[model samples]
Target: MTSASPTRAPGPFSRFEWLVAGRYLRARRRDAFISVISALTMIGIALGVATLIVVMSVMNGFRDELLGKILGLNGHFTGFPIEEVFHDYEAVRDRLEGVDGVIAATAFVEGQALVTSQYASSGVNIRGMSIGDIEKLPLLYSSVLYGGWDDWDNLEGVAIGSRLAGQLGLGIGDPITIVTPNGPQTPFGSTPQIRSYPVNAIFDVGMVEFDSLFVYMPIRAAQVYFRLYEDRLRDGVAQPDLMASDEEIDAAYERVYTATAVEVFVADPDATARMQLPLEQATGRPMVFTDWKQRNQTFFSALQVERVVMFTILSMIVLVAAFNIISSLVMLVKDKSSDIAVLRTMGATRSSIMRIFCITGTAIGFIGTIAGFVLGVVLALNAEAIRAWVSNTLGIALFPPEVFLLSSLPSRVDPVEVSVVLVMALALSFLATLYPAWRAAQYDPVEALRYE
Candidate 1:
């Protein structure tokens, strides 16, 4: 007697199902149109993901560079006396420096003045600070391209920015004229104080606005020029004489120095809010304080909003590519309906047929996402060089430092953000396949083959 043939079973997603999926994905000349559509879908997804990564990276770069430069030059926060004058600035400065988490505190005096050289004239902001304070700020101290620090404290001496020097055609040891209306008042009215100061140093801070508009002078000089001072002697007003003997100094102290405000530097700028109260208590005075974020809120808020809008708008590219995936799968399901029906009649499970189509679509998504991730990372790593190359080869100004406020284009890729983009792309692609795969699995074998 002949033994009964053992029944065969094609388990869900078995090699048989994978084989069928691979065959369908292979581009046949007869289904060339569907093959082209699938290819375009993959290309679309790749381009979309790459663009998202690049744009996000650029935005992050811009934010970080700007914040560093801003906080580097301006410190994290500042305070101006609410009473209009910080009496005994030396004591106040010392107290602020002694506080925990405080990097340094400077008695900062600032005033607006008109500067003129043989070449040109411009309105500039003069910062009056001691040489000791300048040493604590790396942005200014490390950026001195010419001249020495000793000359900064010399009588009628100053430090100017590189761009300012260029504009005024001034160099080290060259004198620049400053005119401030807030100077000592005369019999008629307020008279502009005009003084010529020799340039001791020139600095380029890699920022346009600051480099062009800032002038540094001795704090004593600033206080004198801005008319911010207090007389100690009850008789005629007299400026302090540091060389006076102890008996002469005791007889009548000429004057005491003062400041417009105190600038505080902290170890952690992000902790500005938490440090504010402590800093105030340390100052031992009533004061009004301002932080960097508070000062540049509008500018930073706009940046954040723009980043979100850009992401939302660019994500539509991936969404459209996902729609392309759905379209290609739908056409594929129609073309393979006969094969699906034949398999069903031969005892193939419905789940196996569905998995076949799902695999085909998801493979495209996975490969496309990987291609995009690699391409995006490479582009971000070389964004600045690429920008320079493109600008040079095209013979055009791509990013002018004066307008863009930076010497070069910046890009920084975050690994977490990139992973998110990849996962999102793959998820969209997988979702695009479900309806078409389900339709293919639901085909009735009897009806599908009756007409064939």
Candidate 2:
């Protein structure tokens, strides 16, 4: 009886197919050159991935750190009055506060001024915000090193940045004199508005711009300092004496509770680019809205461009490694022609032969990619320690604070970015295998066996 034609197989693919694929990956002593090339290919890919990981992580850290500081001091979107001051600022602030994305909305006044202490004098940006607003900002509140936000609320003093205080040789409780550009208009021309407030706190925002030039005062004090009181006086508000009591200062500040701009903090600053029109429409006033991205576009744009350029340049190293994989596989196919002929004689199909080499080449790339991912993550996590070690050992500073603005090297790996890198590596490697694997598959079994 003719037994039922031998069952072809139970599974989709034969076990023998994988067994032969695995065997092709091992090199005999005679094929030692191929083995060496394969090893070099793996090493090159690993190094490229590791370097890319370190660089991208550092850039991500830099962007995040700078963004945190910038957003800390500034707003996601700021609405400026078309006129000199926002007369209906409370209405505007209330409207903005009711917006969906706005977490907090506050009135702010910022202007250039000269601050003087007993020891020295420096130009600074006099910024005014309410005590309640200051307390709402953890970045500002937690950065206070010497005193509390309560001091600013009590109208007892103002908070100056750390570098400003250092330059003026002043500290908390020391008196700081401010001279505003818009001074009282007197018959003897306009004299600079001068006011002295005790330094109630010192803040270190870790940014040269902020630390060296910004001084924070209560909204009323800032109004008085910036001559906003002049507008109040015009509106039938009584002018107070220089040694005005706290009650008088409160009344004066309340009368002129207008802001030059309303700073709106959002849940996501990155999305602020698209919110300008919406914000302007919501404010229901003829106001101009400026987002933080627009304010620092050049800086952030440069970083993004550099990151793209760096990624492209670094990916070339992996491409070169892929070339090595091509060469090794090509040589391997040439050397194993006799084996191909024998396997074909043993009933192996042409597609099976191609899959064997493809598997071999992909295994090399897959293994190398895994090794690279591990090495990259380790290096990125310990980048600071590595920087310190290299600096100490080499007697050199890799990134100087004076030049880089940051005190130390920083790195932060994003998992999504890492996954993209890994995928790129594997794709390049698998693509590199196509030509060589196809070449192996094209061998004429008749001619190959004729020579054998």
Best by lDDT: 1
State the displacement of the C-alpha of residue 198, model 2, in Å, after optimal TM-score superposition. 3.3
Question: Which sections of candidate 2 miss by over 4 Å?
Answer: 1-14, 116-122, 166-169, 175-181, 186-188, 193-196, 231-257, 268-285, 392-395, 401-410, 445-452
Q: lDDT of all the models against the reference? A: 0.86, 0.83
Error of 1 at 133 (Å): 1.4
Clashing pairs in 2: none
lDDT computed for candidate 2: 0.83
In candidate 1, position 335 carries an lDDT of 85
Candidate 2: 10-residue stretch with minimal lDDT: 4-13
Using TM-score as the measure, the top candidate is 1
- After superposition, the stretches of candidate 1 with alpha carbons farther than 4 Å from their true spots are 1-13, 234-253
TM accuracy, model 1: 0.90
